[model samples]
Target: MTGTSPKHDVFHAIADPTRRRLLHLLVDREMPVTVISSHFPMSRTAVSKHLRILSDAGLVKERKVGRETRYRLEPEPLLELKRWLAFYDRFWDNRLSVLKHLVEADDANEPETAVKPIKPQAMDPLSLD
Candidate 1:
């Protein structure tokens, strides 16, 4: 079977710091390009390019409002990412649980070491220089 489209994968879109910031900006509410660009240090055109990548990835949706285009987060694509991470999380959890049990069992089987008393050594008698 063929693999999924590169553009639709959430990982590729979120790899860039700028794109991740853009997604965070859109989280609370939808915003126009001008408003979103204001939050970033880059040019408005650069912001638009990032937004276009987000749109292609299915992570954001765009709506034309008269002469301007507004963008909002489209979270459905992120569900796949969540599921992928959750699978690994469970895998690591199980491995860690097994490791903990092994350590506890080893501790139970080992004999405890008794604390030894420190004996002060007597000073050696020697001729004074």
Candidate 2:
């Protein structure tokens, strides 16, 4: 392993918008750096740097073909992220369901009323009435 810090997590790899788009582009099929660079306005070198981060995070796999390097999406690592998000999804769903139930129950107990206007108080500071 290189002397790089072990700060390369899947979350960190996908944190950048460019890197996320790169993953989306490679989702269907493997593509070479040149083709992938065409989808973005950045330089090929910048795209390569993003790919390197994804590679380090295990979100992508690189294969060398003749004179070019191809990259493919490695989605297994993202399953961990999906599972993490799904847990919170369930938590929020349960909480929201309970909230809905409470609101509906409260509405059922209260009767609907027409709007009422308050009459002005006849108090005069000067006449003491």
Find the candidate with the highest TM-score and give its number.
2
Candidate 1, residues 42-123, lDDT tens digits: the string is 9999999999999988899999999999999988889988998998998899999999999999999888997589998776
Looking at candidate 1, the ten consecutive residues that score lowest on lDDT are: 1-10
| Cα shift from native, residue 112, model 1 (Å) | 12
Q: For each candidate in turn, give its C-alpha RMSD to the true structure in angstroms.
A: 7.9, 6.3
- How many clashing pairs per prediction, in order? 0, 0
Whole-model lDDT, model 1? 0.90
Angstrom error at residue 28, model 2: 0.4
Clashing pairs in 1: none
Residue 120 lDDT, candidate 1, scale 0-100: 85
List TM-scores for all candidates, in order: 0.71, 0.73
Model 2: weakest 10-residue lDDT segment is 1-10
